[model samples]
Target: MRIDKWLWYARVTKSRSLAQKLATGGHVRVNKDKISSASKTVKTGDVLTIALERRILVLKVVALGKRRGPYEEARLLYEDLSPPPPPKKHAEPAVAVRDAGAGRPTKRDRRKLDAWRNDT
Candidate 1:
């Protein structure tokens, strides 16, 4: 099967056009060799490395699926060999407390700012 078609059927890409773009953009590799064409043939047992939006994937082809099925069925087409995703980072608290477009500081605000600065 064509590499792009296989990618779509395997649920690697949402659409065949996107798969074609990915393959032609030089983001798809087969058995460690870079493939620059969407028509590249892929057979069972071939290994694929694809760069997606948020993560990279390494998959070993298990089957050439007949149709674009549900996620469960599509998963059977390839064996995921990619490493686990990194843990999410925690959000940091904002440093600046001033609101936007608040205008210049008043006398009291200046005194508070001076006090806050001296303490810091």
Candidate 2:
């Protein structure tokens, strides 16, 4: 199956066109070989390396789906090999709060805010 079609059928991308763009844009690799065309064929057991926003996915194809299916069905198409994402760190809350009706900060207010930001 074409890489783009497989990606779409596997529910990796929202559409086949986006899969094509991703493949042609150099964000996809098949069996460690970079694929420059969306028409590249993929089969069972081929490892796919896909780079998505905020995370990289490594998947081993287990099946060639005939249609774009539900998430449950799609889950059976590939084996995820990517590591879990790191936990998020809690950040300190903002120290300053203005009234809802407050207008733009004055120069003096700006200075105070800058000083407060620097202190943290």
Judged by TM-score, which candidate is best?
2
Candidate 1 lDDT over residue span 1-120, tens digit each: 999999999888889999999999999999999999999999999999999888999999999999999999998999999999999898864443678899888999988988887787
The residue pairs that clash in candidate 2, if any, are none
- Residue pairs in steric clash, candidate 1? none
Clashes of each: 0, 0
TM-score per model over all chains: 0.74, 0.75
Q: Give the TM-score of candidate 1.
A: 0.74
Stretches of model 2 off by over 4 angstroms after superposition: 94-120
